[model samples]
Target: MGIDDRAPGRPRSREADAAILDAALELLIERGAVATSIEQVARRAGVTRATVYRRFPDKAQLLIATIEAAYGDPPPTQEIRDVEHLLTGWASILASPRLRRLLRRLYGAIEDFPEIARAYQRMLGQQRDQARRNVFERARDRGQFPPDTDSDVLLDLLTGAGWQHLAIQPDNCTVEDTERFLRAVLHQAGYRPDGYRQQLVPQGQQPARPGDKE
Candidate 1:
């Protein structure tokens, strides 16, 4: 039977969904993606294995859903403004130590369990990339970047900067600190949004420099 097949108008159990996702996240963090299984999650969540299987046919989808939950409510594609918006969102997510650990594990899984990565890409990657590309295209039109700037490479670099922050910075890194680092990266990349002044720098605050006291 399909996962969505239920009595007409019956509400899906939010409590059950929360338990299952929480259980799956704990397992993934503890054992990595390779060792986490629906059986294990079901036992931990105190639900039947069939319950998890109904919601997620396979492990990849379950893991992806867990990661998506970690992200909280994502902004609609239409609300993705320029690089500043992206940086703010990225910094907010990186500020969470729990999410940082989850992301680290997922990053490691890219090589060992490529299918999960592929599944995520198929589900969410293309849509997010297109939104970012639109941001870049608008920036180009506004003359913030050179017309020839390649959004793909720019996107890659920006993404790598976030990961580097995650991998390098201490778990206690502040959201303000993270945003400063992200803005510095965008500034370096010539991403100056049309502003009154300061070029992405906050009023009266100089751009953050490498090794500056945070």
Candidate 2:
């Protein structure tokens, strides 16, 4: 798409949609949620403001759409084939500098751009949480966690651990390290898959016992 070649009428092709979404994502990562506007995205996308608005309607929706596109497939909900699958997916995402920066921007927007937060919760949070809950329940069924274990609490714990790594320790984050950390948290929380030591613990390293220092 040329600088002046705006698609007329409604967006009719995947090219236009991809261009718009890609431009929006780039601007969001570069300028953040507050500074990025439909006009800027339209210009960057080589489409008109009307073209962008016809797809997104508003900035909140546009930003959320960009984020969801970045998340890719299988999404958090569909990626939960098992505990390992879930943790690995999260570790990969958290280890990404781009995604980490994007998340930080969104975190900042919670107070400044409340609409974005609301849109994110509605569009992504609920389904992701439910998928995680299902994973926890499956773990319980397999005796990784006790029958009485509370999936909600486990979910909160794991989610908090991930955010702490993403937000509080981005400079030191790595996929291997994040995976190990999440596995340690799960081990400490009474999660023990079959052959837990073989699968999770590194060679000759003692698994974290309950009540041990975090």
Candidate 3:
């Protein structure tokens, strides 16, 4: 039978599901994963505990669903105009206190819950791959990067190691550091600075010779 036929009493409401996820996110941000209880979410959402349990089996499932809702779906199409745009997006995500706290909790919880952690990791991998493909496609369309560039390698260099370090590091690293690293890597990979001229060279003129005075 169809979903509606199976539950003839009343179909599950999407609105209530969204409210539960919203409540879960707020509680998670305020009290963290360990302290946030299912009852607290139900109370916050003004729904019964039965409704919450009906949507999510347990706290872990709820947490996972909440995270997915917060991020929304991965972009259907990949596109990266430049390093600046990429860095800007990265900075925005990292700078958000709510997102940071949620990520930190996810990282810690992964150790205790391997299955959930693996699921998250799989989701992340898909996002990274999609992002990598988008970057190459955009760059090629703009003629800014060589068509032959290996997008996968570029993504690994830009995100793989550095992301792990940022996520696991004890001391917090500023977004500036990440931006600087990205710029250097892009320059090394043949990206030219668009707005700024190289220092030690005069604008609209070539560098002065050692024997010739300026």
- Model 2 misplacement above 4 A: 1-11, 73-79, 195-214
Candidate 2 lDDT tens digits, 1-214? 5443554663366877889889988988888899999999988888888778778889999998888888873464565788888889888888888888888788778888999998878877888888889999998888677668899999999988977887677554789988998999988788877622323777887665434486
Candidate 2 at residue 58, lDDT?
A: 90
For candidate 1, the 10 contiguous residues with the lowest summed lDDT are: 190-199
Superposed Cα deviation of residue 142, candidate 2 (Å)? 1.4
- Candidate 3 lDDT, tens digit per residue, 61-115? 7887898788774453435566568766665556455677777666666675565
Reference-based lDDT, each prediction:
0.82, 0.81, 0.66
Error of 2 at 44 (Å): 1.6
Cα lDDT tens digits, model 1, 1-214, are 4232466567877777998899999999888999899999988888778778878999999999888776774643536877777778889888889888888899989998899999988878888888998888888777776557788888988899989998899988988999999888877776666521324776897654434476
Clash-forming residue pairs, model 2: none
Sort the candidates on lDDT, descending order: 1, 2, 3
Q: What's the CA error at residue 28 for candidate 3, in Å?
A: 2.7
Q: Stretches of candidate 1 above 4 Å error?
A: 1-11, 73-78, 195-214
Model 3 lDDT on a 0 to 1 scale: 0.66
Candidate 1 whole-model C-alpha lDDT, 0 to 1:
0.82
